[model samples]
Target: MILAADLADDRGWKGPNSATPEVVELSELLNRAKIYPLHDRPENFRSPSSVSRKIGNLIGSHPSAPRNALRTSAGEVPIVNRFVDDRTPMKRQAADIRVRIRRGLL
Candidate 1:
């Protein structure tokens, strides 16, 4: 996930109008991205698994299952669960991110 995000950042988020303005505390980012995960079967939409396979494996899968993934087989993959765009509140996200930085998550 970090790698992919870095890739996205590297590529300037690809395509026109890709800027993730106000990524944190952004409703659209949270709504379109956040997920409640409960993975036991095949998923319907894309996830980090799909992202790694389809986008780039070096990006890596999100370490923890997303917050909104469900037990349903037809659940949307990246929706509500993966990092389509940034959603972590800037301040709250800092601590966790600092840990990641210390551990080289980026």
Candidate 2:
């Protein structure tokens, strides 16, 4: 969610297209973090499509989201709000997560 929010803030909303570079990057990051195991069902994997959907959800839940944003789940609102209200910490955590993933510590 933090990464997606950062992407949206940096690049603006790109919609939920798996082929988009933003979604693909996020998917790659998630996969590198081992968010989904190869032995798991294909549908359970954090593929580009899944990342796009999650991005959509996070964008939609943001208070300043676009008019055409997707309908967000209630459970996601607080997270989105926190990301918006405390971006510096959220970004720091995201960076930490990325470092851990790269170092095989996640």
Candidate 3:
């Protein structure tokens, strides 16, 4: 949406030299916003555990597993990259993501 908005601006859609009113209205805005990963709401969140394997063991799925919580020098636990579940919440399930962007685990 940001990119589109920028593109619209660059294309003289919102300037003094604008041709007709090429205004992307709220309905069009809704349609455009649907294309991106929306952080504000749940799309297809996953179980906080079982983040690694499609078939998760208890250890792998447990949120407080020692392995899962192990911290790096940066003081952040590693993310489950290979089997990343889009279902995972941007908040609790991925503490590192929250910490990196929003400064703490909620």
Per-prediction TM-score: 0.21, 0.79, 0.16
TM-score of 1: 0.21
lDDT of 3 at 76: 19
- For each candidate in the order shown, give its overall lDDT on alpha carbons: 0.34, 0.74, 0.28
Model 3 ranges off by over 4 Å? 1-4, 12-21, 25-27, 31-106
**Which candidate, 1 or 2, would have the higher TM-score against the true structure?**
2
Q: So what's the TM-score on candidate 2?
A: 0.79
What lDDT does candidate 2 reach at residue 28?
Answer: 79
Give the top-scoring candidate (lDDT): 2
| Consecutive 10-residue window with the lowest summed lDDT within model 1 | 54-63
Q: Across residues 25-51, which tens digit of lDDT does each residue of candidate 1 receive?
A: 222222233243335334534343344
Candidates sorted by lDDT, best first: 2, 1, 3
Among residues 3 or more apart in sequence or in different chains, the pairs in candidate 2 whose N, CA or C atoms overlap within 3 Å are none
In the range 14-91, model 2's lDDT, one tens digit per residue, is 465788886787777777776656577475477888877887887888787776778788777877777778878877
The digit string of per-residue lDDT tens for model 3 on 1-106 reads 1222222223332222112222223223333333445575353222222121111222232244456532322211122221133323422433343233343222
Candidate 2 Cα errors over 4 Å, as ranges: 13-16, 41-44, 66-68
1 or 2, which is superior by lDDT?
A: 2
